[model samples]
Each structure stands twice: as structure tokens, then as C-alpha cells.
Target chain A: MTDRAPGPVRRIFTGPQRLAPHLAALSESSEYGRAIHNADPPPCDAPPWPEPHGGTPGTGLPRPDPQRSAGQALAVVRSGALTTVQDLGRYGHAHLGVPRSGALDPPALRLVNRLVGNPEGAAALETTLDGCAVRPRRAVTAAVAGAPCPVLVDGRPAPWGAPVRVPAGALLEVGRVVSGVRSYVAFGGGVAVEPVLGSRSTDLLSGLGPAPLREGTVLPLGPATGRAAPVDGVPTQAPPAELVLRIRLGPRDDWFTSAALRTLATRVYRVSAASNRIGLRTEGPPLERAVSAELPSEGMVTGAVQVPPDGRPLVFLADHPTTGGYPVVAVVAERDLPAAAQAAPGTPVRFVAVRHRSSG
Target chain B: MRALPVGDRALLVELADGEETAAFHAELLRRRAAGVLPPVREIVPAARTVLLDGLDDAASFAAGLDGWRAEAPDARVPDTVELPVRYDGPDLAEVAALWGVPAEEVARIHSAAEFRVAFCGFAPGFGYLTGLPARYAVPRRPTPRTAVPPGSVALAGPYTGVYPRSSPGGWQLIGTTDTVLWDPARVPAALLAPGTRVRFVATAAGR
Candidate 1:
């Protein structure tokens, strides 16, 4: 699992300029009939996509015994960056100090699952900045959504955001994210890792669920049910150029100075490079607090906009700690958090205070 | 008392004190169990606030907070769980010296107190108990240990807490407990959820 691809990866093109002939043979095995070799050759200076052990596409790679396609399981070949299994979240355990970890981009997860005929809450693989590659042990219907990326099965280009049936022993590589920080991948049958606290979500803060997918990790998929939704394509929101988070002022806004409150709404902040599942740290003007006293640790929820002594506001995410000592100036709306999750480092962030809308 | 808006779907109801917060939390928990408050996702109780998340309208819910009475039946009827403690800790002598008492006397005072679970945080099943008198309150260690072993009974600033799992903490350690404070395999998982009454029964140090 530790073996990593050396050097930079090659760019995979669509609508084919050139692909090695072996890709067509691999796609013929599946009834899906999706385009096979959509890759254009690398530019003269660019490095070619690495081929493992000089193995030719589809045939030369060692075929482990084919497990039945009834369940869609995949063997990890290249776990690019940080890839983890995620569902909706683990709820009803905040009092016990468990974090509610889930897909940071819920809409993306839901759409991918919908395309693959799985329930919205079904567990799926979430890949970070650089995408991951896996070889299905069995033929499976899957879709890549969220961040736009090059999708390939057995060196053959597959449609992104549409259902693609990947045959057994084919390498399904999700290329580097083009716009967003994370991507969602869903199979017909959900990733069937053992659920902890009734969820398959990997809680990075609490070290829950199966550890982040490493190169040799084999993921078990649930029994396939139903057929992929018949759709040519699904539209998705593009990663925002400026991440604007709408927030409602506060459970503890009084703790901050009037100038600090105004600064929060008016000032533009940039997303910090140190941002992770726990929080979206900002590298902007530090907010000044009116009170310097330490606040007793209290319960914190997802989307809590907590301000530390340093004054930089940290917008909590799915895997945020259940409790925090710092006062929260505001909380971002649940719907806007998905975009917050996709925000890249250095992306401009502006907090806009809006009147609380009653949806109930 | 005031109901502060936490977010669009949650409210942080500020109460007069920790007792009032616990009472309100108990009342809300009762309402949730009875299906009266259906939209409630999580009910988190801190020292002076009870955060209720996943609601339909937080403003309306907060406005209606007054009508929801804290009844006698829901008045902190805590589940008492006795924990056997070995009164041998790194900070036992220091804590005893701070209180101007012998180490055995410090253990005696800790064991005699009928502590109420104030709130659960820091780690799972780690409850901050409020039973010690104000005079007995001790400050946290100037430096925190890199890793405090699980089930370590510790004291810091008017509260006594047991470290549910091994984690870095600044609290002054005074004893150790064999009680399984947290076990995911068991139902409830946390032995000391909020409002669970706790009593430290001192055991022989080497036992």
C-alpha cells in the first residue's frame, strides 16, 4: 500500500487523439459501451502516465481470481493523496464526544449515488486534491462526481458524471481534480466497510472508520441493487472563484467587539493551506475580541464559526470536534458548507451575515 | 435566561447556572424520548448553555422555550455509577499539598463527595463532575502531560474528570479508575454520559 507512483502524472485527454490499442479490447468486455481510449498523448515536455512494471493495458497486469460482480469491490492500485470512505455522518453521539464525520460535499455524494442507483446515504470514496485509482475485483457500475476529473477504466476514458460499467480487473483511475479540492465516487452497491456508530464515514478527527485508503487497501461493496439511472449527464455547480459563506450572527457574538463583528462581515479572508476535515482556517485580518477571558469548553456543531485568540475565524466542517472552548461568532448555513469543503487554499472567502430564514 | 441563535436550525439556551442548564437538558431529553420534540438531532449541555441542533426554526423554538417547563420528574434524576479508584497518581501528592491535607485525606475527600456529572467533553465518557467544594478547587498543571492514560481520575478548576481514553491533558491527576468509562462495543458506549452521578470508591493502591 505504501508504494507510490514516482514523478508527476500525465494529462488524460477526452475525445481521443491517441491511446494505445489495448484499451479498446478491455472496454469490449462490458455491455455499457462507453468510449474506451479518450486519452491524448502527453505533450513533448510532459511526463507520460506511469505504467506499472511495464505491464500492457488489460492483459499484461496479473489477474487475481475474479470475485463475483454481484458485489462491487475494488483493490486500490494508486490511492492519490488522501482518499477515505464517507457516508452522511455519525449522529446522536456528540454528548459522548464523537465527531459527526461525513462527506464534506454531500450534494456531490448524493448525485453520484443517484447516478449509480444507490441510496444517497450509502458510503462512497472521497478523494482529496489529487484523485485515486482502483481496480474493481468485479464488474461494477460507478460514477465520478463533485470535482471534474478525467475518468479512465483500464486505460480507456469513461464518462465523468455518467454511469460507467467497469469490467473486472480494469484500472479505474480518477485523475487530479480540475477545479475543486475533493471528488466523490459512488458505485452501484455502496462501499460496505464495517460501520462504526451506525456510519461508514471516516472521522479524521476521532480516528474512526477504516483508515484512509492506502495503495493496497481492498474495499468491500454491498450487494448490488437496482440499475443505474438512465441519464446522459448531470449538471454540477462549479467550484466557486470566491467562496462566499452566508452566516447568521450568533450564540456568542457579544463576546466580540463591534469592530470585530463588522470586520467579519466586511473583510475578505483567504482560505488557509492548513485547512483539513476539522476546519477551514483562514489567513486574514485577526478579529479582535471584546472579552479576553477564557470561555469554558462548550458543545460545537458542524459549521460553527469559532474565533480563537489569534482572531482568525475557523469554520468547522464535518469532522469538527464536538466541543470547543473558543466563542463562535456565527454559524454558516448547512447548505453552504459543501462549497466551503471544495474551497481551495488561497481562495477568497467573504462572510455575509443574512437574516435567519425559517424553513421549518 | 436567554435563547441565543446558534445557527439556522439550532439554539443555544443560556441558563442561570450549570444546574439550570442540566435541568433544561434533562427536560429536552425527556421531550425527545416522548416524541414531542421531533426535530432535535443533538442536545448538548455545557456549563451554562444547552445547545439544541437540527431544528426547524431556531427563533421560534427559542421563543417557545419559556412554555416548556422543567418538571420535577425530569429534574436531574441521575444514574449513579460507582467507580473503583486507586488513589496513586502523579499529581496526588501535589494536589494533597495544595489542599494542606495528607494524601490519604485528599483521597477520602474525593471518595466522600457525591458528584453530579456536569458535562461530557474532551473525550468520550469523560464527564466533568461538580461535587468538590470551592475551597478544594485546584488549578490545572502548568504543563500538560503528552499522554494521560485512559481512566485516569484528574482534577482541575472546580471539577473532577476521568480521562476516558489516553490523551494529552493539563488537568492534575490524582487517581486511576478501572471502570470502563468508554467502550464502543457496549450499548451507550460512554459509562458517564451527562447527568450520570458518579462516586469514586478508593481501592488499595496495588490491587
Candidate 2:
């Protein structure tokens, strides 16, 4: 595997109707935002691996040995919080028993890139529950998207959505759980990690590739060096109580009885404490299947609602399993993933069925 | 043939011929290696379908089914893989007790024949190997385990498999081994691919 630096990953938003500019804007780089556009890195060592169930604390955000950097771009993950390298996801190998696990809130990940003027698909630090203390090795523009974290740069409060710059050796801190569960921090120079399988996201379930960020892991950084585009704003946490996630009927929507579908459509489902990125388990009235015949296991996409014998439908989030036997009654649209990702445990979540396609 | 839009570059093809799914997937793999597709990221072959995702559009891609469905009817399938396992797990004792048979006899019946990796699912690394010996086959536990160890040999319904990783399961464990069930780092991650043959061997060591 050749060790080449990668290009800035392109982020594709599903819709043109942008929601209100988010609270925290990503800081790709001040003025000249192009520093985040990375070059297409040549192939590196990507071996087939075991499923990683959970990220090891020691390896959470940093690499033991500093990655070979391509340009002057350098960033350091600081103390506290859970920050992991996330690309889109590990794909194709699902048949080989890999989960397409990555960002639970993709829109946030994409927005993080756009904020810093980086391509959306670029690997960024996904901070879950808690965020990290970030330090830039150089004066580079960066942005924070997704979760409602009270961000401070060098002891001064930093705005969340728009891009901001940190001088070399400056201390950047992000406080936890202002509203949502996950936060994405994108550097003007995208965070650089060796791609395992097809992505940079650490597959904790498949015990393959680099571990999640750990202390003393100074990650490799990439330099895009692109001209700054006019910055659009970032999206922040909406009113948590009134968040309504959009849903798309699945191919197997007929598997459930009409009453069951109606109950799913109208009844309130509460996010159980067991919910996480792997999948969201809900506490709701148990669903009953119309037929007892076991359905064949099939491929699933993000947002699939699969029901088991117990009738509890698992709303598969970003790190969901490859395939499932439960019939998927519905799927949450891309537009609604942010809200779904923000569904705090025990948060009352109500599913409303809608006829929406991916309106890219 | 139906073309479902995901976002832009990706497309899903619903194949009616189960045999060709493998064949078309091989063709796509070759294409992927050759750099013919600038966008495709994933090429997923399911029971009777294939979903083509452009690397650039995986997040939001469209599946061009009309062309792919017509083209996939006679594609060449990939080769099958075979697997070996020991039909023993922790739950083997309970299953034998419920069936009024000794664990040794249970092992004999389990090793009697072969199975197929008909499907892969459940957890990340979990593969469904079908075709279990009728006598050894049993219903899943009424109450599932909160967590089952990885590489656990188990049987439930007409299926026998090794748990890829520790996960909640209802299958009866017969034995355990170090052989990884689902390893992503290894090529062909699932040791037992669909259409692959599987035979259980009784060994002196049972974990």
C-alpha cells in the first residue's frame, strides 16, 4: 500500500433547501479556506480486519506515531472527550462481515467540511457525548458543526458554526452536551488518517485498522490549499422537544400489519438508554408481525427500522449492522438524520411517516 | 428493472436471478480495480439484487437499475468458499439435556453433514450458515443471552453458525474456537461465503 496523502473528500447534501444556518459554523480556514481540500492519497496498508465492537479508550483520537504529513498542515487532539476519525464508512466488505459504520449524523459531518471549505467526505474528528481540547500545530482555519457544544479558543469563547483560526500552540476546548449527542470538528486542513477498508472511521466492532483517538496520538494532517468560497452558515441543535424526524417507507413496509404501521406512525417511541451510534433501540409498544414466517436476512441502509420477534423496532443509526432478519418498516430520510442523531437517551421520539425521496 | 435514486452516482439493481448476483458483483469488482468508475464506493450483492454506490455519491447516490438489470442476467458468478468448524459451544449441554442426548452424541450428529453460508447478517461479522442436521437443530432460546462470546459454534432452527463477535443471541452454543468468524482485515472477510460448503469436525479441544 502506497502512503500518499488523500484529497479533500467531497460532501454531498441531499437537499438544496438549506435549513437555517446552524449555531456552530465550521472554520475551514480563515479568509483562504482552500487549505482543507486534500489531495487524493495513494493507497495505504488496508488489510481485511475483524469487526471492532467498541473504540479502545487508549486509541480513541490520536495515533501513537505521528502520521507522515504532506504539507505544513498539522493539528493536535487535546484532552478530554471521545474523538474518533470518521470518513463516510467502511463499505463493500459488509458481505465479508463489515458494518458500514461512520458518522451517525452525516449532515453534521458534511457541514463540518463545508464550513472549513473542505470537501464534505473528508475525514473529521467525530466527538460523541463529549468533545475534545483541540490544538492546531499551525495557524489554520477550522470549524465545529453538529452538537451544541460551548466552544472556547485560547480561553475566549469561540463561535460554534462559522470558521475560526487558532494560532500555533493555542488551546481550543469544546464543552459537552449543549444539546445534541455528537459534534464534528473539521480542520481547514482535513484530519488525516490512513484509510482502512474504504474509509478513515475506526471500525471498533471489526477490530481492524487504527484504534480510536488515544492520548499522545498526533494525527497526520492534510493541506488542501483551495481559495475560500463565501461561507454559508452552519446548523445547530433545534428545539430538542419539538424535533420531528422524517421517515421513508421501506421495501418491506408490508411486513407489518396496518395497525402496527399506524401505531408506528402515530404512537410515541422513547429513545432507550441503550441507544447509541450502533443503533437506536427505542422503548415503545411492542410491534406484532402479521406473519410468523421468518424473513430472509437482507441488506439494509442507514435509518432502517427493523423489528425483531419482541416487536421492538430498532432504528438503525450510522454504525448499524450490515444486514438484519427483521423486516424494515421504514427509513428515516437524510434530512432527518441530524435530529435522529441528537435524540438523547430517554428523549421522546415520535415517528411520522412521510413520502419523501432523497431530494439531492 | 427499477432504478431507485439514492442521491446521484449510486444505483441499485434488483436482480431476479439469484445466481447472477455473484457474477455481476465480480464484474463490478474487476471494474473497481481497473479504475473504470470514478465515483462508485460500494458494490453490494444481496439475495437477488445488487446495489451500486459511487464512491463520490455513497452518501447520496442513484441506482441505475434499468440498464444493470438487463445486463446482469448472464454475468459470471464468483467462486465459492468452504469452511470447517467444531460443533461445540457452552449451550450444547443445555440443548443435549433438553433433547435427552449426551453431548458426545450431539457432536456426532452435528458433524454428520455440511451447510452453506446462505446469508450474512445480525451483527457485524455474524454469518448465517444454513443446513444443520435435523436432530441437532432446535429453536432459539426463549430468552436470549445478553452477550455471546465470539467464535462460538451454535445451532438454531435449521441454521448452524459461529458467532462472529460477542453479541446478544438466542442460538444454542455447542462449542467455541479461535477461528475468527468475521474478520474485516482479511480478504473475503466472511470465511464462509454464500454457496460455500461447510463441514463440522469433532476435535479433542473444546473451549
Candidate 3:
């Protein structure tokens, strides 16, 4: 309720004479002053809101509008793919079947947050594949990181991976990604969505935090910090043509035969299109299970390489289920999980087994 | 006991039984309070295994687990939580018939046994408890209900549990409880955490 935006005046064109000034004001507010001014003058007379229709409590009639304060940040114009608010994650609740859902590529979130002068754990919009466009209610600085995408402000090209000052009411459009699966957008402050269970990240598996972005969803921005880290250029890795995930054999590795383990390490798998925040499903030869007997469900962690009865491996991600029944043959190192997020469908994948507890 | 590698930052410790699992879980909790396992973030206990996540040096921790001792009986027993239940459920008659006992006898048998929280899964605050004798094991509904209401006391193979939130379940419902199993406002939220002991008391009223 605190973040709700004040209602905008419903402008009705009486004649062509009044429309000229409105159109001119829009053009002038751009990076260059064409004809528009900073303030768009309000109409001389505005109609008061109608009284609420009272029939019955359950009656399908319109109720009086709650007080809506103007939002300080971005207004979603076009939410692309599957955008959701994300922070570090919700932790310490795995025993209760809660997954720690956060940004799949944490590095991208940190990079954009640094560019926008926000804290590392602040919530941001994670856009999948095709990017999103937003219009800020107040002037704010923003940066796009993660997957490479075109950054544009009111149809003018803006620098990617660097902070760009967006004037209030200007459309900041992030075009579809050139490569990779997800892109992150960080505001000057951060996404000020309400946190659920100590995290703002949306859990698709458990349905927590803010829901996935839809058109016209207004997101509040936190107050911007003055201290932004200076940077010449932040280094970014390209989307992997072939995702090579380094993993360590697991506690249930003995359940698989030697041939299966060999196949896991040697064979090339393709990233499945069904992959989402839950897990990175694969399409390849199934890893044959030596033990056909059912094992009781066990706790699953991020990056767990669990093999189902079908034999194809599924690398658990940020939104993976807390407990699973499948046997986990290996677990990808935490460091290599970011690359998994960026991997697109049909991208070749290889599992490289490393020494237990070894760093990549 | 065996400590097996899960990944670079986690290790799965397999124990002999649910009692040992509970003891090991309590030991981890005790050590975590003393700041011994500084890097360990989450310690999740299942039926016969405990997963340690976010460990700084998993290999070293696994090595140290070999010498680790299970805590005393006093330390192993977590706080016991009591739930008041009404001995009325849709499946109560079916369960009584299956056990070859009257409906009143079914309630007596369930409340007579002492229960311990073995592990938590399926939903938040939903703990699978161990205490029911093997003879009382009941088959799940051939077709699971589309929605089992929260607080529905249910029994399945080797475990008795309450549905923390409405979800599809195949477990046989024996009764219903009004006790709040999960509250987000409370510290640790889940009332039925792993290792907590539980006792169900039958109430006179159904509603």
C-alpha cells in the first residue's frame, strides 16, 4: 500500500488544440529538450471520484479506491519472457520444504547492483531471454547486466552494463537478449517489493515473494545510496556455446554402475527447453541405475545432479525442490552454476568430475 | 555412520536409524551454537541421513565427523509439542475396519504411542513422525484427494503427520487438529521442526 502510485489524471482530448501541447511535452522531456517541459501542467478542472456503490459485502460491485501514493521507481510497460523480483534467497527453511529461490546467476545481480549503487542483496528484476521495458515514475539511474541485450532510453541507444540516468516518464527498454537465457536489470536503489520470509526473491515452486511480471505492474524503488563503486569496465563472460559444468561425485554415486559414471563424464548432453528456475533438464543418454530399488526421499541442495528413473540428469537450481526421491549421482560445484543459468536450449553440456570439496 | 560428499560445499552423513539421525542432528545443532561449524549454513535431517550445506571445508568436516560423538539423551530430546485433535475424520471408519478394531479403539491406539519427529518435508511445518507400530501400517488412498485441508492428521506407511497447508495427499486421514503447526511470525516458524517430540491428545468436540 505504501508503494502504490497516485492515480494519474485521465486525459480526454476535447479538441486538437489541447493535444498539441501534450505531444510537444512528451518529446521535450527526452535527453534533448525539443519542446516538452519538465512539468506537464494539470488541467484546470478535474472530476471528483464517485461514491462507492453499497449493495452487499459480497456483491460484485466496485469499492472505493485505497489511497495510492506515487511509486518512486519503475512501471512495467512490457514484461518480457518470465521476469520476477529476486534477491539473495530465502534460507534456513529447507526442512520445511522451502527452496532458497534467488537469482540463478548471482554474479549478474551483483554487477548490476554495483553499477546502480545498490547493495549486493537488493532485489532486482530478472528477465528471461526476451528483455523487458519499464518507465520510471521518478528520475532514477539503471543498468542492465547478465545476458547481453540492447539498452535503449526513449528509442535512443544507451550503454549496456553502465549506469544511465533515466528521466521520469521516459521509457527504458531492454531489448531481447542476443545470447544467453536470462538478463538482469538493477535500478539506482533497488526493487522495493515486499519481502516474504526474509527474501524478496520469487519462489516459483512455493509461490512466495512478488509474482512474475505482467504488463502494468508498478515496482517501487528503494532510496538510492550516494556511494556507488567506480568502475572503468566490469568484465563479463559471454554465454557459453558449450556449457561445461564441473561436478563432484555424490553420496549416492555407488547406486550407479561404472558404465553409468563413465557415460556421465564422457557423454555430451544438450540443455532441454523445459529447463526453468527449478532445474536444468537435459536431453541425452540416460545414466543407467544399478539399483532399481526405491530410495527414501532425501534433502536436495542447489546444483544437485539428480538422475530420475528416465536416466537423464537434472541439475537443480535456485528454485529446486527442498527434497527429492531421485538418486543424486553428482553435484555441480556452486561456482559453475552461473554458467548453467546462461545456457540456452540445445546448448551442448559436459559434466567434468572433480576432486571432492575441490574449488574450480 | 558414513560421511559422503554431496558437492564442494555439502556432505551427506548417513546414520543407522532415525534415532541416530536425530542424535546426529542434535550434535550438529549443538556444535553450530558453539560456532564450531562456522561455514555450515543448513543442517537438514531426513529419515536416516543429515545434509550439511555451505560448509567451508567439507572434506575436513567429513574427516572430523569420524571422531564426532552423538550427544547425550538429555541433549538429543528437543522440545515436545502437544496438539489437541478431534477423533473424527472421513477415513476414521475405514482405518478402524482395516485394523479390525472399533473407531474408539483406533483413537486409543494412536494416542497411546509416543511420537518423535523423524523429518520434515511435503510442506512447511509438516513433519513425518515415527512411533506407530508396524502392525498399524495403513495403505494410502487408491486415489489421493485433490486437496487435503491444513491440520488434517494423517497416517501413511511408517509415518504419521499433519498437513501444514492444503495440498494433494494420499495419506489416510484419521482426525483433524486446530493447533497452528506453522506461523511465519514466530521465530523458527515451524512448530514441528525435525527432532521435536509430539503427542496428540483427543478432544471431545469435532469442530
Candidate 4:
């Protein structure tokens, strides 16, 4: 495949220029733009379209190693809790029941990838709670972002958020987070696992891509090309002390009693230990249903806050099933999900209802 | 049909039943293929609803859905997948008894019927097939098995399915097949996608 990056024309459409007209129109029609203007701006860091494996073409970034060898790999010395390979995710396959699996903290993953000079959507290791350790076969640049964790090379302290070069065969250890639930560790060329349906992300629900890391696993790395981003430590979001999720009442909101809706908007809920990649289960008063009859299985989406028989709401996550029988009371806005991912068990969660944004 | 807004980017259109869902899904696919349908990331059909997700403007799109009708699907031949099976599951006798047929007749009865995939869920490539008459519908096992081996042809309610992978299931297994239901290496991955016709051909017992 040609390694050409997307030209300037595509960049203009994706950047501020495209949104300028909308902003201008909004300013002219003040009353109509109330809802639309209040909506959060689309994340600027993400490309408008899915980036193909190897590199993000639209970013005008250089492709990682064209002549990468199998010898350029890492040996897992310590596989911490639930470490898995992740990228942006596999998309457009929910019709066949495939889950869109990817890094929970997408911006953090992108930051780490940038620090190591890899594309934003390149595959990397996502460690749960405790971090992991690996020994590179060849000296390579690596960075850790998301959930603020300590970095060590051969037991010596290393920078956490900036790219650090480790010598060949040196043990690069990612220490447990002082807080937060997950952390991302990215290498210069990114993890070079074989892609399944155009993604290297491990789907825990559908059991796709590579399995969770185990001690003694060997992961191949692509060739390093461009230089790491010239930067010191980057700023990162801290784990939420009190998780506040902005939600839009949903397609099945009518199924719930009015009292339930009030409870959802006003009550305080805690993050349950049962939460995982599938859904963020909550510990709180169950929402009373207006319609108690069973709902025939219907398509479920990421961010859907589905309430089961127990009445507690569960917010669907990246690896959620494509369909479900439970009624969805609301959907959390996508922008707030990275904070939800880092919410540790017992963290207080408050769901605030928001008016759906009108089309811009 | 009623289209309800699902968040900012999706609409769940409730249909009358499975037949209506299939027809509506077909019409949506036709419109999409013709580039007339609104931009959507996924058009997923389930039991009695079709979810149009990742819409550019869900409210307007949902408003437009009121005027839409379920068109009769074109009579083009659908893709057919033939799976060879051995009627030798541990629950074969139990299923035969439930069907009020002889043990051997169960295989013949199952092999004679044609099936069409209605929807896929539970796992990737695991299609919920609709073909058997309502009378042939069987209840799920009283208790689920800890592990139902992959390729086990099973029945539950009015649906027939083949386990794509080893998973804990409550379906009544009447036979076993060697066909690979899900292979990520294969293009499209799923051997039996929604709307694909399927036939189970009875084969000799040994591997």
C-alpha cells in the first residue's frame, strides 16, 4: 500500500474551516442555536474517518517501520491484570453481532501513541489496575499515558507521560496506578498484532483479536520511523472524584415510570464492582418501570443506560453486545466516557439529564 | 411502525413482528445500497425492531421514517450454506421424544426443513434462524450446560442455531456439525449472516 498521507484538502474539511459555517449560522440564529451551540464540540484530536492500520493518513504523519522484522518484538515479563491489545476499534459490523472494541480512554491512547511517534489509532497495551512489564528485543522508544502511573526501566525510575528510550533487553516496567482504573502503554511502532476485521482491539464480549496478555507472551513490533513528539510531560485528566455523566433520556425512556426518571436525575449512584468492559453496572436504587413486560431483544448501542429487572442502570461500554432485551432509559454523551472508564469501584456517580442536541 | 429517538445518533424503529422486521430491514438495505437512505453506521435488525445507528441527524431521519413502508423484498435468490451434521448429540433422544418422533426420524425431519437467518446475536456469527413451524418449537433445557461445544446444532423457542464457539448455553442440542460458523480469517467472517438460507444435511456418524 502507498504510504502517502492525506493531502491538505482533506485536512481543511476536517479542521476548523468546516465548523466555521455552522458557528456563523449559529451566531446569526441565536434562539435556534441554543441547544446546538451548547453541545460539546466534536473531539478535535480524532480523525473524521477511521484510520487504516499502520498509520493515520489524514494526520500527515510518517508510517512506522516499512522494513520491520519479526526480531523487533517484546517479551512479556509481567502481564498485569487484564492487559489487552487495543486500537481505535472495529466498526460497521454490529449487524453481525460484533462489538466495537477499543481503548476505553481513547484520548490517552492517542497521547501515548503521539509521544512514541505512532499513529493515534495504532494498537497498544491497555493495562487494568496494576500495570505490566515487558523486555524489548531491540532498543525502542515507549510512553505511558492514562490513569497516571509510574514508569521504570530496569527498576530505575523513568518519565511517565513522555517518550523514554530503553536499551535492548532492558525490562520496561509500568507500575500500578496511584489512582484510576486503567493505563495505556504505547511503543514507538505500536503493537503489531494481526488485525481482525480491520482492528487489533481485543473484544472481550465477542472474544476477537489477540487474547489478554499472559506472562512469557511475545508481541511483535513494527519498525520505528518518525521521531517522537518533541515534548516534556503532557497534561492528563485525573480520575474523577465524583463521576458526573451527562445523559440524554432515550428511545425506551417511556418504559420507565416518571418517578424513575426523577430518581435517575436526582439520586446518587455508586460505581459497582460488577462493572467491566461490557457495561458499567451501578449500585443504587432500582428505577421503577412503567412497563414491566419483557422487551423483545433490540439493537443496543455504546453508551446506552439499560435497566434490567433489578432496576439499577448499566451503561453499555465499548465491548457491549449488539443487542439486548433490557430497556434503555438514557444514553451518556460519548465525550464523557473516558472519565467513566477511569471511575474506580465505589466512586459516586450522578446522572444529569440533558436535552438532546439538535443537528448542526 | 414507530421510530423512537435513541440518543443523538440512533433511531429504534419498532415493527409488528419478525416478518415485518425482515421486510423493513430489506427495504432499508435497498435504500442504502441505492444511496438514498440517510447516512448510517449500522442498520441492525433484531426480533421486532431495526436500529439505525450513527445517524447524521436522528430526529429528522426518524421523522422521515413515519412515511416509510415495508416494501416486499425482491425475489432474488439468497446465499445458501449447507452444513453437514451428525444426529448424535447427547440430547438427541430427549429432543426426539419432545418431537414425538423416533430417534432416527428426528434427523430426517430436521434435514428436510429449510431455514433462514433472522438475526445474529449472543456471539459473532451465531445467527438466530427461523424456519421451523411454531409447533416444532421446543423449550430450552431446564438448566444450561456449563459448556456447549462449538458447532452444536441447537433449538430453543422457535429458533434454531449452531453454537459458533464453546459457551454456556441453555439451548437443547439435537445434533452436532463440524462446519466452522465463525472464522475471523475469512472475509465477512460469519458463515451465516442475516437473511442467508441454511440447510442441515445429515451425514454419517463418524468423523
* Predictions in order: chain A TM-score: 0.80, 0.73, 0.79, 0.82
Q: When superposed on Cα atoms, how far off is each prediction in RMSD? A: 13.0, 11.0, 14.0, 12.9
Better of 1 and 4 by DockQ: 4
Higher-scoring candidate on DockQ, 3 or 4 = 4
Instruction: Give the better candidate number (3 or 4) by TM-score.
Output: 4
Query: Under CAPRI classification, how is model 4 graded?
Result: acceptable
For model 4, name the residue pairs that clash: A65-A223
Model 2's DockQ score: 0.22
CA-lDDT, candidates in order: 0.76, 0.60, 0.75, 0.79
Which candidate comes out best when scored by DockQ? 4
Model 3's CAPRI class is: incorrect
Q: List the pairs of residues colliding in candidate 1.
A: none
Candidate 1 local lDDT, A228-333, one digit each (tens):
9999877766677899999988888999999999999999999876677778888899999998887776788899999876789989998776777788999998
Which model is ahead, 2 or 3, in terms of DockQ? 2
| Tens digits of lDDT, candidate 1, B98-130 | 999988798899999999887776555667789
Q: What is the TM-score of chain B in candidate 4?
A: 0.95
State fnat for each of the candidate structures: 0.48, 0.23, 0.45, 0.55
Which should have the higher TM-score, number 2 or number 3?
3
Return the lDDT, model 2, position B7: 27
Per-residue alpha-carbon lDDT of candidate 4 for residues A1-360, written as tens digits (9 for 90 to 100): 000100111111122111122222211222112211211211123342455565534222334453665568999988775677888888788988888889988998998999998878878999877788999999999999898888999999999899999999999999878778788999887787666676777776666777677678798887776589899988866666799999989789999999999999999999876677777778999999999787877899889998877799988889888877778999898898888888887889999988755622
